[model samples]
Target: MKHLLYLFMLALPVVATAQKDSLAGAVQATRPLPLYRPGFALMLSAGSTGGGVAVGYSVSRSVAVRVGANLFNYDGTLKSGKDTDDIQIGFDYTVKLKNADLMVDLYPFKRSGFRLTGGAYYNINTVTFFGKPTKDVKFNDTVFTIDEVGTLDGKANFNKVAPYVGLGFGNPYTRKRLKFMVDIGFFYQQSPLVTFRTTGMLEPSSDQGSVIQKNLEPLKYYPVVNLGLSYKL
Candidate 1:
């Protein structure tokens, strides 16, 4: 009976130690995680602006910044007017979109992916067209050969610095190593400067650049929609 009592006394300390450890673990498990942590991430995206890559840094739970570049180019042919019309023209055109951006994101809610983004883009967007008569063209009552009608070449350029505003979804500081992000926004690029040259009979049309520039006034606000994946680094 004495030995049994000694054994119980010795085992009591070990049992108390085990219970204390178990309680500590339970308290730790129930504790809430931090809302944000600073980190760096890499992102690859595709959207109306084209394909792009960016590097981002989370300054806090509510704010982040990114720097990136995007590019897209298209070359194609366009036909306008009809063969039966006084003039039928075919165009060889190229559209190029290229830009670099510095952006900031603000999150208003804790543990939410929604964010507001504002930024500036170094814009280099252009459209070039070369048009030639596809068939004999009539000027007043006189019909002229394609060679006499000649070709018209023109280019349209936008402002160099554009301001952007938009909203998006994605939080790079989350516990997840990979996250999906999206942005939808618009940037104000101001008016486009149009320039053109004409050869042969089309020389008179060169002065019409102002008219084309006015027609493109609506292009000042460029829309952007991007979908991407971000990997925390």
Candidate 2:
């Protein structure tokens, strides 16, 4: 009995060491591992920046790049009086906004869903102010030609390449296949070039293009807000 009791006591340390090593291995196996595969995503968005679809490619787990196109249009009428005559003139206006862009997003926190974005946008936008006399203007008791009465036609050109900055939510890829996103940003662009043209007596008014340009000074900056959904591929 004494011999058996001594042998059991001597084996205790060996058994305890084996159990400790087994527990350590189990804990190490449960830690999350980084995925090394590349991924892609498709997104649809809408807001002041316009509505469009974008495609993204993952450069790495926390970085991505994308490209997209967007468009918007507006139509309306405007009225003004001729400088030399008391007759009123009317014009039909068409405003168009178009955009093409490339952007990069950086996800700084692996555990959080926030990102910072920067990009460049090329805008092909124009505003046309135009109208013709529906009926001949009775000026000084005589009717006038579009040239004599003056055609109210002018175009404002906003051909610009601008820089953008913004903040957003969502990863280029997620643990699951789908994710929700939100972005708010601004585009920095300068004032546009304007041209005014006419025929007949009012042709001299073309020189007033500078005055027209000043009236449109408030339209230089563009605001953007977007809500989007993305699917991984």
Candidate 3:
């Protein structure tokens, strides 16, 4: 009996070593595992400084769609005079765009059960602009006045829609409680409905509140940047 007890003790370490080896092998095998799930995501994006958010739903492994909105504002100084401290040029332009997009993911990489995806996308965007500003301006030979503040007011406002396409990248959804990603892309399109409302501080005030300076200019096709994130359910 004493001899058998010694043999069992000697075999215990061998068994433990084998179990450890098996566990390590299993971990290494799952190093590249793909994740699959039917899910949805909430995305927020900022590009060239513009900002927005989107909501998307994944119907299959390679296809999904989303819709979203964006808005931004900028301010600066244009010029000033000797008596004047600083003639600030504030561009209070607000851009509102409603968008719908279709996603196609091709490049795929899996690590630690997470699947990463990259592909191309097409989006249709409707953009609108609302511009309002206030400034102090001097006439050809007259001194600037406090009432010039309202006189300097102007606006460029209109709405239009366009279509564009670009590359997109993100993580594929897994059958998990939560998932997230970021997307950046380029777009080419045109906006035809942009109109400018001008005030006559440099000239004279008309009976009408404001006047359209010129016909709306079409926003030509150009590259755009986007970023976003999402959650899975």
Q: Against the unseen true structure, what C-alpha lDDT does each candidate score?
A: 0.90, 0.78, 0.48
All predictions: root-mean-square deviation over Cα?
4.0, 8.6, 7.5
* lDDT tens readout by residue for model 1, 179-224: 8999999999999999989898888878878876896688899999
In model 2, what is the error at residue 95, expressed in angstroms? 1.8
lDDT of 3 at 188: 41
Q: Find the 10 residues in a row with the least total lDDT in model 3.
A: 207-216
- Please provide, for model 3 over 1-233, each residue's C-alpha lDDT reduced to its tens digit, 9 standing for 90 to 100: 99999999999999999999999999998776446666677767776425766676776665566666665554433322244443333433333333444444443443332233333223333333332223455556666554554333344432333444455556536544444454544444443433334453433433323222332233344345655555654
Error of 3 at 32 (Å): 1.9
Worst 10 residues of 1 by lDDT: 30-39
| Estimated TM-score for each candidate | 0.82, 0.70, 0.48
Candidate with top lDDT is 1
Ten contiguous residues minimizing lDDT sum, candidate 2 = 31-40
Candidate 3 residue-wise lDDT at 191: 38
lDDT, residue 2, model 1: 100
Q: Quick one: best TM-score, which candidate?
A: 1
- Residue 216 deviation, candidate 2, in Å? 2.6
